[model samples]
Target: MRSVSIPDAVRCKVAAEPRVDAPHHPITLSFTDGVLTMEGELADLAAKKLALERAASVPGVDHIVDRLRVAPARTMGDAEIRDHVRDLLLEEPVLQPLARATPSLEPGVPLRPDVVLGTIGLSVARGVVTLDGIVPSLAHKRLAGALAWWVPGVRDVVNGLEVVPPEEDDDGEISDAVRLVLEKDPLVDASQLGVSTRRAVVTLSGVVRCGVERRAAERDAWCVFGVDGVTNHIEVRE
Candidate 1:
């Protein structure tokens, strides 16, 4: 069986999900030879005990990688602090919305799975969201950032998502006319050029040999979009 490595981009989704946090830290999942392993860590004995119970609930896990180190038992005074903190996270409406949306949100794509949308991890007093895990792409990273901004009470997002570059598709092709125009233009370096369309708005980026080449690429792209402006960010190369 082939194993898929979890990308950094998906970490954001993991951090945001309430089910995953469950007091378990650094949950690692791996499947090979028809066997699966799940590992967890926690800050203290109570958390470790809670995490083990939660880990037992996860489906499709064949093995448990237990690395939890038991911390000194918390005093009643400390437990009181924990309760207060938990209450603050639960009361925040924005965090609650995320806590609600995350449970049902589709895994990956438009939104990645590792992004934790819940309030449990958000430090409302400090106005910072502590996120973990990986994202599949920079676009998803940007998407996660945008989602964080939408939350009502959130003043700032502390992004901790690792960016995972998408797999390259080298068999990509461009229209013959566009390719010809790019190749014939002496000012433009066709090799570094990239063309993409969204709602028919053409975007072009890459390195140009000089300023004239950059402008030339823009003109060529304009022909494709046909009167629509092109977002040309062609850098001048020495």
Candidate 2:
């Protein structure tokens, strides 16, 4: 295969992307044979993903090597991280409605904001945040997880949100939705996977090339509405 040299125009375009622009991100870009290598330290996983996505958008870039490190603004204890996550969730407009949902209270009983927010269970262990609750829509579930990632010192996020849509989904509908998502994802090979849904619980069984692809498949399943839980039994060949 012939190697494609990196063009100056492509480099400039990639460098100017708002996600990786300097002063805040300060990433080092290199290219060879249509492969772009991004190396730097960012605040969180979302920024790293954004930078890689932007780099891949540049024309002529065929593959990306992500070497970006997650360096939080400052080191924080687990307790502090949990507090920060709560604050962010409460402040987020998309999640405030859920966070401020008024729970059933006795007559003349003053509302407890903390109890309402507690419905969205949050637990942090070594920077890994676990969110547990039932949300009204898939959008709310996803938004809450994204907001958790934005919190400083959040190394990773586990979104355990159950979506309770207005209309309940049957097992067949959910299974079809998961399969469609897997087929549409560029990284997942739907042919090598098996998807099944029972009582809103999805089970994936198959082989993938790597752990990244396996995780990608699971994420796609989660994206489908009405999926109460995911059981990823996909084996990684490599």
Candidate 3:
């Protein structure tokens, strides 16, 4: 019989995951009252989820406080990040229906306006993007968060966008968004990808021709809101 400390067990799990790149981004784990807190910087959103998944699977671990951050995709100033995020939201075709119309605002055209609380509002300070507003459905909220994550040079995203007349969220909703995003991604072949979700944890399976496609599928899953964990089992074969 072997008794491994909780911290050691978690460490081994994270280190064994090649996607985590544990040596570059060291995760500091602290266990207290059955809650595990992971604090550190990770290379990407995929790595952050992978590390959290590892910690959650460890025996005796109950909850996790994700203090992990993904290194910004690029380096830019506060103003630049804010503008990029705003432009992205305005550019999304699916979100056009939610775009509020104003005096002198043309129909069927999404415009970039100042931060409006009730509608889509945007702000950035110190590389963190804060989205404040109301969306119609859970899919919209998740889509908004994913778009913010796509912006270059964003360290973190605070998804404060509230769902108006709240609707129920289920694994089906998450799966729908996952598939939609993957379909929209030019780098990914969604036709060959299988997506499923349980308890907000998404599992991606099926086959792709290259590692880049496999990684793209995983990233799309991570971008979806309500996704607590992502298991990328998509095999790469040429």
Q: Backbone collision count in every prediction?
A: 21, 0, 0
lDDT winner? 3
Single out the weakest 10-residue window by summed lDDT for candidate 1.
Answer: 168-177
Model 3 worst lDDT run, 10 consecutive residues: 109-118
Q: Model 3, range 167-218, lDDT digits (tens) per residue?
A: 8889999999999888877889899989999988899999999998898788
**How does each model score on lDDT?**
0.44, 0.69, 0.82
- Residues 24-55 of candidate 2 have per-residue lDDT tens digits of 76777778888878777765453555565556
Query: What local lDDT does model 1 show for residue 106?
Result: 42
Instruction: Indicate which candidate wins on TM-score.
Output: 3
Order of models, best lDDT first: 3, 2, 1
- How far is 20's C-alpha from truth in model 3 (Å)? 2.1
Task: Decide which is better by lDDT, 1 or 2.
Answer: 2
**Order of models, best TM-score first:** 3, 2, 1
Instruction: Kindly indicate the candidate among 1 and 3 with the higher lDDT.
Output: 3
lDDT of 1 by residue, 164-211 (tens): 555332212223334445654556678888776553345677776778
What is the C-alpha local distance difference test score of candidate 3?
A: 0.82
How far residue 74's Cα lies from its native spot in candidate 3, in Å, is 1.8
